[model samples]
Target: MNFTVLVPARLASTRLPNKPLADIAGLPMIVRVAQRAAQSAASAVVVAADHADIVAACAAHGVRAVLTRGDHATGSDRLAEACALLGLDGADTVVNVQGDEPLIEPALIDACAALLQARGDCVMSTAAHAIDHPRELDNPNVVKVVLDAAGRALYFSRAPIPWWRDGRIASTAAALPSPAPLRHIGLYGYRAGFLRRFPALEAAPLERIESLEQLRVLWHGERIAVHVAAHAPGPGVDTPEDLERVRAIFAAV
Candidate 1:
């Protein structure tokens, strides 16, 4: 579908420094991520890094890599800069694959892209699924998204959305029907032109309060088409314990 996958890798992770280069099975996590994205049958796969070491590592594994400004506020900004550096065409679609998600399902990547292509009016698209656990609903780290019947996001929040007026899950469960409180997947797919235009959107109060960059788009009144993935999203590496868990998962796989 004339698309590319951009894997943004920052070397100095506050939680896990040099995380992109961290080993998974036999390859760096970022390399494995790029390979998985490549499985989407994307026209090209590129690793956008801020450090020379990351670039070298990507090259070592024969993955296309490019250097970008390290000061980007978020990976989306870094991806935009990478798109500019690589001279990516504005008409093409670029998938923002998280570098830490080495086990990301390729079908999810394809699904996100398919939504963007099938519904061209939305400049950006993402995936979501029902939050299976009540504990996850309260965890601020787990972003939540609510979508309209047309599959367009209504809001993204760190707070428990569709808040229970009764103040507890025990009561809330009885009030509502089955299936609810969609969890936002960190993955994104964007038009190359939209990626270039994204950085200009000013931060809104809602985004600042929640610390989610995606909210800026919603606050600005832009529609984000949502795709409901068939499978649960892959794990994201954030802490040392997460790395150990991921290592064990990979070992088992």
Candidate 2:
């Protein structure tokens, strides 16, 4: 079987409530996200969510959605359950797309899945983009990632990384380095077998300190393939202001 794309949507968010149902271009945000996932080369595109509201929204929009465990700590956990419900085999590749990204490109989805397929040694694959703006460098909300020459992730941190000992790192007040920094994109692709083992792995100190589950995989000595996306990932709708901003952007598309 070919790879499957799972769109993970949650109704609850600390910053903005009922984000999946938020309207963008007259359709629910999750609906628009699903539409984008459908453009992928995936054999199937399904929404994995915990709330009935999200499920109903997908149904109304003629999209496939499945209710998952409400207690899943992470979106990846939700995707695992979605795969189980769909009866995917261990070797099946699963692409996890965040539902808040209504404008996520289908090509990005295909690219991530293709990377995982090409690199059989890695169980997980994700993406990054060169951060050019000065504001994005200091924005703690925009997670940063550094990768090795082989395009494998070295670290994922919310703080500024690769401190320039002579330039930016030399002075506390020095301007942040705007070039070569890669902002981590939230989309992920994982083999079904590895995903089933994810929940059982003990949490690592770095993961707990940073509140990032992906860190646990790195800390456990596993390599995650990183793909450099050609374009910036569309801004995800996390706050009310962001909702308005995304709506305006989608309105023009």
Candidate 3:
């Protein structure tokens, strides 16, 4: 049941510059994310930051953080360095909570960790929810995941997976599949050992093509347990509009 939440933060963002340090209400976005993660069942919550300013911001907000190499290609790579820095045991559970997700539900974080703990056969765990909107099936921005009977992800893609054969006609295209296709959630949980080994795994062709990192795990013949959540998660900060929306939500709270 013991798990650590690692929030990977970096100051360099093309959409919103210095995104991690961006102000949300009175606190930095990274600080807000760490605070939310702290509400989970994690034994500890730490921010793995690429910039000194990000680390300083977390410290100012009383959130533990570690300085990671700024050159890391992905958040997983940054978290791998963080795992070493924290000296996490191989068997320990580490949930990767994105620093931009200040509105992430703590229960979702706990569920991802608990699922990873329960599925010893799987090296990682993530979440998904039934896609209620028909438009989302065609929206590449909303990643989709097809799962096996046991709830292990068979694949993750931007394309409409488990494509409805009978619904191929334009008139029926808007109809959802028999069992709704799941919308992949970004939340993830990893075993410390697999996380450490993650950086060394060769980037999969599917990963590069879809621009999805989780594909590398599947390409390497690793299992990722999928927890189907009842409701969709809150919006994450990505663009200026997303930031403003999140700010409005926080202001209301």
Candidate 4:
């Protein structure tokens, strides 16, 4: 049950500059994320930051952080360095929590880690919830994941999957599938060993086209267990509007 939670944060964000340092109820956004993660069952929660300012912010808030190279191409790359820096063993479990999700559910974090530990056959685990709205299914921003009978991810894409063949018309399908398609949450759990080696895996064509990193794992014949959460997680911060929404929520609390 012992796992580490790694929050990958970068200050250079295109949508919200210095996003990790953005204030939410007087606390830095990354600090809030780390605090929420601390409520999880993880043995430790640390922020893997690209900038010293982010590290200092975390430290100021009594949160642990590791300074990583600023040039990492992806969050996973930053996490890989964090794993090495922390000296996590190959068998250890690590949950990757995004810095922008200030209201992320700690129980969801715990569930993802526990699932990874239980599914020895899988190298990683992630959470997803059924899509209730047709517009969400069509929205490219909402990534969808299809699962096998054993709850292993079959595929993840921006395009609506389990596409309703019978409802297709004019190249615009707006029908909700019978069983409900899943919207993939960005939370992830990993075996520290697999996580360390992930950055070296060959990029899959679908990954590049879909702009999803998890496809590379499938392309390399690695399995990812999917946890079907009861409900969708809280909104994550991605833009000024998202930040404001999260700030309002925190302020009310």
Candidate 5:
């Protein structure tokens, strides 16, 4: 079970500039993310940074960091460069952990990696949790995934999926049927070989419509194993308010 956790960190965030350097507790966000990833079953944890400052910040915490091209179209692209820089083999597994997820559970990381190993037919793997709240079912921000009988993702969308025929949406309320929806988590696990080729795959229309990079994999007729996590993942920092919330949570600890 040899695997590496690569945290792709970029300095320029439209919502929160220098987001990777944002402080969570006493450490930078990327440093905190690396620390959490290190706790997982991964053999190594590295921060794939797009800027020198991000690399320096990780170094300050004694974490391994690699500087990647600033113009990478996506985090996956940055990860491919980091893998090549590290000289990883094609069979090696790599987990793409976002730098903003300071509260990410180490178990979830291990689960995704393990799932990819178990599902030889799939090139990638990810995690999801059952959506308990009715509001989340309709919330476009919460990505939903429908899984096949084999636990492979059938489709991923911002819209409520597996739409209940019996249920109806009203002005004040919406009726959701039995069997709660699954909320797709952002974590991903990729084989080093497929990761390198991922960037070259043409962007699918569904991917652009849903703004989900994973959709491209499906559109290209690639299978993605989806593991239903035993527990829900912790919140990730995305905006100023999200940062403050994470800070408060860390301060309490």
Candidate 6:
């Protein structure tokens, strides 16, 4: 299966201003993300930048970058315009890799694309891993996904899902039950045609309440294939603290 990785980068960030240009090791964060995506099975890797500076940063590192409209409300919307600009066919697969995830694994990108290629009925695919800590299950920042019998996402939310009625909430990770909850990863894969139509889909109430864009697909009666990742995804840069943590990890390496 052929796939392309599109890194959607915006200049304005509420938590960390100009996050895409933030330094990681020596290279910019967006450049690092593109370098990792290039190692995957994807046929091409491109950065769909919201600003000319972001496009220039990617170009400096010899990565393909495209300037997209800055007014896009969501990453999917930005990628939709990118697909049109690239002139990608309807059947082609595209993976949406966030620009802030400098530590993202290339294999995870391939896995997500492969899931979509294998599942003809599903319009999109994403990954998740089993949560090992009780705190993570309760944390609203860590999204959780409940899967159906066929490994399709039943729902994605910030709240604790499949609430363990028999178990009591505890502070320690050891107190969690045998079958732990699954934490949803932020990566996604979609067909180029579906990606174009994504922006046209009406915003769903569940999506607005949960603040998860994927829920819009479920609300509109579309199937999303959920792949259980072999390992947890690396942390993404959302705040100054997150940037420091990632920088420290790179420095240690």
Model 5 lDDT per residue over 1-253, tens place:
8899999999999999999999888899999999999999999999999999999998888999999999998998999999999997577899999999999999999999999999899999999999877788888999999999999999999988878677653224554566778999999999999998889899999999899999999999999999898668888988999999999999999
Worst 10 residues of 3 by lDDT: 166-175
Per-residue alpha-carbon lDDT of candidate 6 for residues 79-100, written as tens digits (9 for 90 to 100) = 9999999997587999999999
lDDT of 2: 0.86
Q: TM-score of model 2 relative to the true fold?
A: 0.93
lDDT of 6 at 76: 92
Clashes of 2: 0
Model 5 CA deviation exceeding 4 Å by range:
169-175
Query: Could you estimate the TM-score for every candidate?
Result: 0.94, 0.93, 0.97, 0.97, 0.97, 0.97
Least accurate stretch of 10 residues (summed lDDT) in model 5? Answer: 168-177
All candidates' lDDT scores? 0.86, 0.86, 0.93, 0.93, 0.91, 0.92
lDDT of 1 by residue, 39-158 (tens): 996889999999999999999999999999878888988999989987875668888999999879988988888888888668889999887777778778788888888899999998
Q: With candidate 5 superimposed using the best TM-score fit, by how many Å does residue 95's alpha carbon deviate from the native? A: 0.6
Tens digits of per-residue lDDT, candidate 3, 82-173, equal 99999985889999999999999999999999999999899999999998877787789999999998999999999888788776523235
Candidate 4 local Cα displacement, residue 163, angstroms:
0.7
Query: Model 4, 1-253: lDDT tens per residue?
Result: 8999999999998999999999999999999999999999999999999999999999998999999999999999999999999998598999999999988999999999999999999999999999888888878998999999999999999987978778752225455668989999999999999999999888999899999999999999999999999999999999999999998998798
Superposed model 4: Cα runs more than 4 Å off: 169-175
